[model samples]
Target: MAVYSYSKLETFKSCPLRYKFTYIDRIKRPGEGIEAFMGKRIHEVLEKLYADLQYKKQNSLNELLADYESRWKANWHDNVNIKKEGLTQDNYFEMGRECIRAYYERYQPFNQAITLGLERKVVFFLDPEKRFQMVGYIDRLDQRPDGTYEIHDYKSSNTCPEQTDLDADEQLALYQIALKQAFTDAKDVELVWHYLVFDKEFRSKRTPEQLEDIKRTTIETIMQIEAAKEFEPSESSLCDWCDYPDLCPRRKHFYIIESLPMNEYANETGYTLVNKLAELEDKKKALVKEIDGEIVKIKEALIAYAKAEGVDVIRGATKKAKVKIEEVEKYPYAGTPERKELEALLASAGCLEDVMKASLDLGKLAKAVKSNIWSPELIAHVKKFAVRETECSVTLSKLSERDLILDEEMSY
Candidate 1:
């Protein structure tokens, strides 16, 4: 079995079926988006830049871009989505020029770079007959004074935050682990994510725990992939953002698994209460879902009706409408003194049940209205939106309420 690289592990995690296409089948996807092209181009530039730095060769922006432009053209994959025929010579040059400009502006000012760049595609055949193929590259290795190695990869496109968006990235983690094999003397290795876009750089660091987790997860995933009968697509919100959604079969497999007959639900307790609670919980969730879906449908229809008739139900404080900005407002309704006096008089006369029932009616109206995602049009006609904020209820008297503020404040 071959030792998997950080790239393969990342490919599998991104979308298993897509991963299978590129890595397993070795299909070259066409570059359509600037993001895809720029990332690869940036990688090439960084690899060359750092390689030069390692050997103490000072490289200028023009030279770096020239090298990167050449690499981009040579390594450009024939993506089906790419209208490569339409790309004029001028267009390609302009694209390359813009890419290099962005890169230079981002990195040139930095007097000290932790690591200039890295290259990881260097192939080393271990076996005498070259049967066992092992290919790896240490693009740029930054040896810190503390004797720890900071493994870094360069990227282009829009710069993304490392700590905020890439704190849990497994690619960085796997790279950390892989670097150990390349450098035997380094006792500790640190993973760093560096993104450069339009001359701005964003950096992030990875922990030892995360690096170990990547190693374990990648090994397990690789084993599973090798043993599996098929590589199924993961159908998630991520599917919409994926490039290979049309080719994946994860959704079809879901329907297959859902249709198959299954045994009854089991429990470790083996108690009747467990079964009872399970049944009730499932039923409650289904009912809630149905109610929520229907309510959303109706609300959308109502919004459509209002729009077609050219009537604005929601009156903004100003002349022009707020135009769907997320607004958080505090509303206070003044209590009538006469009404409270009358209610207190009624309570004194032992007619409190009637008043209490009226209050409950208000509650029922709120519950009836509150169900799903709150739309502005739905809140236009009424101030009472059923507020079933998440609450932990042990007993009727022992309740802890947690407000789920979706911004639109309504009582009921």
Candidate 2:
């Protein structure tokens, strides 16, 4: 009975921990970035534009731009952080203005199709049993004279997606399912995306099979999410935009230390103590390596001196070292008669399993599995009796020297 939206499912797919924070735990953050702020403002302007058109009055380009600027200024706040470098708040404001202006000019008079609904909310079941319901808002739904429906979505982003990407869009495809339910007589439904920034429109149509496939995949994804016990944080480039970083285990320490006051951090003697300890440890490692090198040279000298003195043992001031030489035999050729005889004897004694030469090339096997040359069931069967060993190692990377310098500077 989980009702999901496109963004909810996408959030879970991006990072389960983030999804848990937003949906399950419902941890709210203060504010969003300027990009999101601008998108919201533009969406509002567009919604107003369509809403006004329903009243038989079309908003002029200048009027829409004026309204956009007014709303942008009224809603501007300190929490709207501009992430793009060298861009001010005014720059983004003007950019949104241009987007609205361009969109207004492109479809002026607003006579493309009869506006059925503006910013309309649609809900449809993804599963046959009506267990999983997906809800999303269509930016604009229009109808043609031939009973064709178009689901339009507005994108305020600067990036324009490719045709294949538009074709594979799940949001509109899911919306198409809702459209079918809402309009039973809807013969053909077309998915349209208006890239407001680029002022370009992309249209795509989905087959019934495609919608069924999307439903099946969406249900499988939901099943996986329901079956998940541990919501592990997924790291990617998108982490920079994530709002739950302070709560995430992977990023908590960074923010915690970052939030510490410079005076307080400097007053914490443990910080300096740890820094000194790390420096000493690094110096100790170098000294140890040097000492080991000298030991090797001394051992070489001792061996040569012992040979010169024609003695088997060298007596040192504190220790005695002995050099022992033993003769051993090796079979260079595995196909030799001795090796064959040993192999035959071992095979007869049922000990050949210990000496078997077959090696499991795991990398090749993985590639075969990925390429569908080997079935996962077969791999699982082989892995059923597989033994695994865990290896643990300790490593230390020195903290940034700049941070240490900054901390010292702050102390002054």
Candidate 3:
């Protein structure tokens, strides 16, 4: 069995095709997103900060920032892509420095917890069978004086998520499961996230039940990946940062056309076809408006003719039109006061299920009430939601009444 990481699971969820490319085929892509590169440098610096603390040597803020800068310079490559259009390497470099500065100022002494591990590799099984093994590297693990353990993660995201999102986060919570499995003293472990860009700390913990649920769901996802025969691409906002655009079916054409000259790209078959289709669509829209006007007039004349002739059917050359006029039970539209009152009445009467298919299926409810399925009093109460309206509809059919042949001609 392959060792799964949170990142691996996330990749599969984001795009199964990408997952297959990265993990199954193990395709090597050169470029790294600038955001990820900046994050790596920050993690290395923080790891150094805690590693030094373990040696009874506390590095000053300047020393840490200097280390970060050196690492940033050493690892900087031409392939680092800045996806955001206006941002440059210098912009992200400054942002990284600011993140380090904010973190240093907020937690100066760094004595809140005892550093136990830095960039620690933890591998553990999610179940007793040990079939579904998982692996992760903790950025820092610390123990408080009160014997509570903390699994810390360093995040370099440009945007800060809400606390509710943190509560639902699975990365550190999975680490907590690993901690509990690996150590006897892991009863009270906290999941901590250092949102470096925001200079904020978000903490979360998992109940035993929650941990079990996470384990079960994670296994289910693993099984799904193992059983998948066709890894379909899932397009999202993250496609801009994806490395396999040249390989992805959805993005391959765009990737290939990206290097073409403007004139050639504009004249490309696919591009020309799309432009032509759009032009036709615009013309079709104008024509549809004119056609709809003609249809309304014809319908009104047909209804008037049917009423005058006292016949529902009107004949054309090869088609016949059947006009229907009937009283339809109309219910109050959704979100209306009358709809709400009726829903409340149904709830009180314990018949909410009869009306609710997914939401309130007003059509179903209307039929039930109109059919007198409910008591007289209840039906009377539901009447406020009901209004009768005469509706007219016209349907066209073949003029020959019982021509039940599959084809126009009989085969001998």
- For TM-score, the strongest prediction is 3
Please write out the lDDT profile of model 2 over residues 294-384, one tens digit for every residue: 9777766765675688766654433457654333223223566655654454456454454354733334433443465434564454334
In candidate 2, position 240 carries an lDDT of: 77
Q: Tell me the lDDT of model 2 at 143.
A: 95
Q: Which ten residues in a row have the lowest lDDT in candidate 3?
A: 403-412
TM-score of 1: 0.48
Model 2, TM vs. native: 0.66
Off by over 4 Å in 3: 300-412
Clashing residue pairs in candidate 1 (N, C-alpha, C atoms within 3 angstroms): 29-79, 30-78, 30-79, 105-199, 106-199, 118-139, 118-140, 119-139, 120-137, 366-386
lDDT of each candidate versus the true structure: 0.54, 0.79, 0.91
lDDT tens digits, residue span 173-242, model 1: 5555555555677467665555554444444556656655655565567667677667766656645445
**Segments of candidate 2 deviating more than 4 angstroms:** 261-412
TM-score of each: 0.48, 0.66, 0.77
State the displacement of the C-alpha of residue 244, model 1, in Å, after optimal TM-score superposition.
6.1
TM-score ranking, high to low: 3, 2, 1
The digit string of per-residue lDDT tens for model 3 on 1-412 reads: 7899999999999999999999999999999999999999988888888788888898999999899899999999899998889899999999999999999999988999998899999999999989999999999999999999999999999889999999999888899999998889889999999999989999988999999999999999999999999999999998998889999999999987897899889999998898999999999999999999999999989999999999998878678899999998788778898878878889999989998987899778878876888899998878866788999988889867444342345543
